[model samples]
Target chain A: MTRRDSFLECEPGVIRLFGAADIGTKGMVSGWSGPEEGHNWNDGVEAACAVAVKPPVTRLMLSVMGEPYVTRARPAQEITLYGNGYRLGFWRLSARAETALLVALEPEWWLERGAKAVMRLMLHMPHSVRPKDINDGQDSRELAFCYRSMCLRPIAG
Target chain B: MAEPALLGDLRERPDGSFDGWCWVPGRPQERLIVDLLVNDTLAISMVAAIFRRDLQTRGYGDGRHGFVLRLPANTEGLDSEALITARERRSGHIFGRVLRAAPAVSAPGGPALDRVERQVDALWQDLDSARPPPEAERPSQRLRSAFGTLAGRLRAQAGRAPWPDGPPIVLPAPVSPALTVAFVARAAEAAFARIAALAPGLALARAELLVIDPGIDPEVALLSSRVRNLRMLRDGAAAGVIAACNLALAHGAGERRLWLGDTVATPSAAALLALARALAKAPPALWLGPEAAISFADVDAPLPPAVSLPARFGMALCVDRAVFAELGPLDPGFGAAHGLAYADLALRARLLGVDLRAVMEPEPPTGAAVEFAPASTAAWALFRSRWGALDPLIAGA
Candidate 1:
């Protein structure tokens, strides 16, 4: 197995950033969802990014929102960041991936402007892989087929 | 067929008594023999089981015996009403009824022990199922129930203000000249500010800070080195005020412990000194501020005198180490850090005989009193579902 798979298996609960993440409340608007909507925003981004990339190396990137404000620790394994940047706070790693990842990396100042803000990220994979697992590769084999990707979001306001 | 046996004729003995066997119904084991004699002009029987004072006092008493008529004919149907009536009057109260004669059948051997055993067993079962005797229930049962309720409360309070170690510290008189404080706040910056403002005023040989933060912001991290006595810890919003206080207390050492709110803007340095001094003069297991008013009353003991403070006031409490020796640490089950479970501790201090008293403050500290955030509707709903009958603390007394 690759080092990434071993790392994922050894500490499946740990949340790691693909690239640099800003710690602030303001960012670009990329995706939106209703509180009750069941649609997977990350998958939508993956599909969007998947089709946008060429066949040789199909790639997808997306951001998922997390809990609001700051907490001593994050409670979930798979976290979602919105707007710009990556790395958020950490929490106890669950051997199992979280059912849902919510990101509130932006500060209260930005949150007051709108109900929420979107965290940005990048996703990449080989052309042969499926698009479904692009953002949720750690969770499913289908997404693992996507090959490689990246995501970015801010940590605080 | 053989004739059944009848009551034998009673005969007077040398002690001016009558003695002989009497047949009684409802009892199949053996026929009773009653002996009668004159005692104080009453016809007493020697054949009757004699009841002594010592045996009576010890709860064992024999049945009473008196004169009974005897039947003579062997099996000639001697079931006459007159004879039965005479027997009834003579031993009716003791034996209830007189047995009639029938054709006797000879028994092969002595009565069956198994039959007797079965009968005894049935009797015991009846006794077992019977309602408890009135004497078994006393007024003390209520007292015990109340005490149990109070003990449960003490245990819960002990849980809210849990001691770090196995049990609370056992302190000697004139408590080892020590002080411990659990400081709580939302932002690491806010907590650091409180410590900076508080240290200069609290003149102590040693002081330690257990700071809990939700997120580790750079600003939060900056305060780590600012206070020499500070040890920073992090937890979720759900970890709560009482929980953070307990964690801090676990990491600290002092003869007396206090819960200092981390977010409070102003530090009442004088109030801390006054508290330290008040505890020194009149030592109780737990000390609180007289002005620290709790609007909640105990559901069990409603309107408990307001003079006493609830154990939840750990925010500024000075607990004697000895109290912890008797009761253990604060309970994490109360809720995340500033949950409402702190009030329950006040009830415990009272029930545990730890003497909960409020210190009168001549000059009160200045600052908008920090109160816990209001419980969410969902939180309130869950709390009521879990502890509806138990929660006595409410707003406006």
Candidate 2:
């Protein structure tokens, strides 16, 4: 199996980023596979705050730039990503340890209008901390060893 | 990008102005904007001409700009100490540790301190005239009685005129470091011993141990003399704990001030290092850390930076000197020995847009349990009047 990578650096506190790769094979680079055809997978999309994405990414970490749909999400047994306010129910894509699929606007709604690109793709280092620590408690906001920042490219890239 | 290097001490002048120079190195092509931040608020900004002729002599002509900044006297907010920050204009991220200096004490705001006291005093007079049934009086009415009692005690104990009905005494910071680790000294010399046992050298580096000694023990006095920056203020008259803290605040040179209760053990060297590192982050206006019963930080289950267990008495109640210079001192009128003074201060701080934040300590000291002064209805009345809807935990404490 071929592996690929991308990253971002954050600072004032030991923020450093190194190495870059154009893993854009058919527009699927670093876990962000361009808009896979997804439908409303859960009932009553109204009170739902997140979408359960079955992405190829087992880990994802990035500090968002604007008020993007997914600023931060938790890595659950189902690996839940916060709904980007589009209110589209759970999206169950095939899960993997690498690659991410993130968009600035709501993906499903924007995709219906033929919007095919996300602002950035964030992929974090897999299992950097102990497995026990990830689900340690309720206030699990920090996945300490996750990647810090990422840059965006066109969906067609 | 190369980080900015701020050389020379940023000290407060007698006139209450701050002057300092910083060498900020940037990418030759990028335009850097630098700002002078007082208490995290932007006071001034300048487009950095980030280039130096000396740098050309060294090697490449990258943007290594040298800039000088000066802060004029504050004619308005006579804040005791101003937290000075040299931050990047765009990201608002500071390059290094934040510096603190005393701003010019200006009283443009109607001498709010005096006005508050007068208002409180006037209300007391109204309550006295009305003579409400003693058992049915509200908290504010009860406060009148408390202040009256305080006045009586001042007369009986010191045999002097009662405290003036003006305002709570606001002590201006007299030192340069960021904060002073202050404590009231009585018979408990073990507290000083705990502080002495730590990376003794580390404990006294960035902050000073302010022993507000009413009467010094020979061992503590000896410790003060031996330690480099240990200051034992002469409290011969021996004021109450709140008075000692206010006095310590006046004598403290740091722009920030912290009070330590003798009940808890002192912080270790690692703990001190953790504190300094956290301070480097230039914590928000009113960040606080409490003593942990455990010898180490709760790393296995770490809480967020802002959330922390409550500190009792003085589990290190740190504040920007402005807490006093801005919002008055811990109301000494709140009956001595009923130590809700720190909690009362925290409540007021939150109202002033400064909340007591929890500082995460890696090498937290042992004995987190604090013995609070027995409950005082008078203290509760004072707190409720200022801070509506008391914190249930504190109300019960």
Candidate 3:
């Protein structure tokens, strides 16, 4: 796994797309992908990418933008972007980042090519704190540690 | 103070006319005839061009020579329309108009003057009769009686009551740099998540979520790794939590300190900024925000939508380092877990003669609350106990 990539110098108003070499051979990104798809997964990725470049980004965390709904007899998460910002949550997104770059350029590459095309863009910000000191109370200390781990757990995945 | 000057004498002529010669100060020696009149119809003008021989003898008049006026008897008794108009054009108040129109009457000879005097006297009497007394009528003797009653009640209340003394404990500046968070696992997760969620926009450079991780939980480790500036101190020594928080606080480069909720939802960081700005005014002793149910407790009295008085301290408070120096640290004796520290702090602050205040902020999170029956029960009990003991003193019965 690559250690962690920063948003380095990129073109303005244009998204920087990085896809695996094996990706895009299928010409189709599975599930919900890209801006053209109503899902607008690219916009979500851009939003998260934007947050990593700024100071005070003590944590790189993600939360679904909206509630979930039942689609085709199965429960699917409904996402809305840019509402909190001027064009909806866009301000909320951009204000957190110096700038954002959409990570995915292909829509159906993830499903068609399997593992080769699978690219996960995670926020590469550092954790807010680390255990600086270890003191008394063995059981209670263990309890607190357990609680702290629970706080960082990803609710969806 | 100089005594008031006596009115100048009026000279009477053999023809039953009067020529009054008053010694008015600061006047030129020139004999200037300011008015030439035979009756009520008179024409008056200043004459430098008038060639009078006696006027040339003194020779050095700068043309500011003042002179007397000749008038029909009882100018005070005349219809005062002209005087009233001139006064209205000058001062613009009703009092001025009246004064100018009714100049004081000193000449007492003509029947017309006597009649005008009677009319003025009757009007003055009517005004005086309509006026209320200068002071309201009050029962004077009752004041002493009231004070005596109050003193008796105060003595009764203080008969054997013990109020904490000893220069009230002052909160010391923490010698260490850390914060202690005493909470359960789920509450701990919620607290970290809330802070993390707020971090992106909070603009806060230094904030650490020191979670108590028991069992060396990897989830806790993973969560800790996700956020920058977060430290998990495994030993859940409640005092250690306090000690750790003190450490973070001491080391915290930020200008302000905040004690926020873990599981409890909070307003946006902007909202927190708004609160910090409000507290920056360094208002009275106690500063608080809206949505602090801790202040509400079980009091049915419906606290005013806003009140700035020293009272309970709860979640989400910002205080300067000096306040802690003046006040003191949380009494660790409250317990290993979060409990009565706030009440103890508030009471101690009061004993030290510091006034507390609570101000409301906008857009606090709703529906997310910690239901502490024990806290409310204790708060209500304390209020009643204090009230029962001090009612007579407050009432001055």
| lDDT, ranked from best to worst | 2, 1, 3
Ranking by TM-score: 2, 1, 3
**TM-score per candidate, in order?**
0.31, 0.34, 0.28
Please say which candidate is ahead in lDDT: 1 or 2: 2
For candidate 3, lDDT tens digit of each residue in B191-305? 4545455553244322223334342222333332234333333333434334443433332323445554332345454544444444445534433333232332222233333
How well does model 2 score by local distance difference test? 0.41
Error of 1 at B28 (Å): 75
lDDT of 1 at A129: 23
What is the DockQ for all candidates, taken in turn? 0.00, 0.01, 0.00
Interface RMSD of 3: 50.5
For residue B171, model 1's alpha carbon misses the true position, in angstroms, by: 24
Candidate 1: residue A37 Cα off by (Å): 74
* CA lDDT, candidate 1, residue A80: 27
- Model 3 stretches with alpha carbons more than 4 Å out: A1-157, B1-192, B204-218, B231-235, B238-253, B284-316, B336-339, B359-397
Docking class of 3: incorrect
Alpha-carbon runs more than 4 Å astray in model 2: A1-157, B1-175, B188-192, B198-205, B216-225, B287-314, B337-339, B358-373, B388-397
* Model number with the top TM-score: 2
Instruction: Estimate how well candidate 2 is docked, as a DockQ score.
Output: 0.01
